[model samples]
Target: MTVTASIDIASSPEAVRAKFLDFASLPKYHKGFFASLTPLGPVEPENKIRVVFSSGQKMYAPIEHNTPTSFAWTGSIPLLFTGGTKFTQEEVFSGALSFLMGENAVARKFGFPEKTKKGWEGYNNDLKAWCEAK
Candidate 1:
């Protein structure tokens, strides 16, 4: 299962993409959702970057998609969880554990997909506002 959310931004795709791809600026503009973001090095497919969520969870994921208008990453552990904050210009979740985890105890308790949907929506709104304001 995957949860995703997207919105139309008045800004150009390049401008929106530019702001989203700049991971380091996340905390400054997307303050409510991000604590701090640090890119380990040159960002490109296969490179790993570190992200600290506002909830204080620090995760590391490999760059899965990086392009002119899209970006995504995957944080995985063998055959289990391939999850994280879903930092795509879109908010998303997937993988073997997307909806299955030891009888869905933790996932159901935390409502990962639902919660993520809300967070992703917030991100979309935040991104749109920032991009338009520029």
Candidate 2:
């Protein structure tokens, strides 16, 4: 399942990229994001970073796509999550949340209905607030 959101931001792609690179600033606006972001090292597209959640869930992911206008990262599997985040600067700022539960896991683990969808919705709303804020 995937949940995505987009909004227009009156800023250049470079400006948006700058903001995206600043993961530590995420929680200040993205309510659903980590309570705090700790940069372990340089911010490269393939660099891995640890995300410690307020709820004490620690997840890690390497930057999957990083460009002058966009960036994306997929959560590290069994230890982290299934999907990650994406941003695009084509008139509107866009964000996406996707979960790829393997067939075995889906059938055995998270068989809970509506749980995943709700989580994604919350994530989308938070991203919207963060990106659309003036």
Backbone clash count for every predicted candidate, in the order shown: 0, 0
lDDT of 2 by residue, 7-63 (tens): 344445455555555676776666653555555677666676786655677867686
- Which 10 residues in a row give candidate 1 its minimum summed lDDT? 77-86
C-alpha local distance difference test of each model: 0.62, 0.48
Query: If scored against the real structure, what TM-score would every candidate get?
Result: 0.74, 0.53
Q: At residue 45, what lDDT does model 1 achieve?
A: 77
Off by over 4 Å in 1: 76-97, 100-106
Highest lDDT model number: 1
Q: In model 2, where do residues sit more than 4 Å from their true spots?
A: 1-12, 74-117
Best by the TM-score measure: 1
In model 2, the worst 10-residue window by lDDT is: 76-85
lDDT of 1: 0.62
Model 1: per-residue Cα lDDT over 80-133, one tens digit each: 111222224333346676564223778778776666667667866887787779
